[model samples]
Target: MNAENPQSPPVASVPLYQLKAEFFKTLGHPVRIRVLELLSTRDHAVAEMLPEVGVEPANLSQQLAVLRRAKLVHARREGSTVVYTLASAEVADLLRVARSIIGSLITDQAGLLADLRAADRG
Candidate 1:
């Protein structure tokens, strides 16, 4: 426990179950995913995102609060409004990877459907 003991390994802290739960809970909403996607493009105020995402002001605020708490997004006051942006470029990269996987899955499913249709017609 002594900081001066260079030979000692750092204490292993208990896993943060509550923090993990909150992070997943925050990401559980579709609106939050859309918000993250928009932020990945560029920083924007809640007002700007509202019109783009078609969510009401109150709903947007709620979603942003969840993202902010998870540290997935960061906010700063810009005059009258708070501009929100992804906490890091890695967050955008993660979204891109997720989208790629989803696209591949959808394409595979479509191909299967097409094959089934062709067989049925034959």
Candidate 2:
């Protein structure tokens, strides 16, 4: 039931998979991923991240805003600086898993490349 219009039909709910995809889409940016990786270790003030992220201040701010909107990170103001922290410990776990997956893929590719080179010589 719509609060504004009692007779109006309820809005369609987003599918769980669709929501998941949207969440991943939010993490697709390199800057956002770096930000998350940084927060994974410990909370950091915006100034602390600027040098590590190596992006213009405005660009980093935009990435932080995206992470904030996705609920992957939380921000708080401390005097003159805004500090950020991961919303859940699971986010750090997720990054570790992703790193492992990518590492495995790279290792597999390297093995295949070595096999191909050996075959060429043989």
How many Å off is the CA of 98 in candidate 2? 0.2
- Among the numbered candidates, top lDDT falls to 2
State the lDDT of candidate 2 residue by residue for 50-115, as single tens digits.
999999999999999999988899999999989999999999999999999999999999999999
Q: How many steric clashes does model 2 contain? A: 0
Best by TM-score: 2
TM-score, cand. 1: 0.79
Model 1 per-residue lDDT tens digits across residues 25-50? 77779999898899889999888898
Please list the C-alpha lDDT of all candidates, in the order they appear.
Answer: 0.87, 0.95
Q: Give the root-mean-square deviation of each candidate in angstroms.
A: 4.2, 2.8
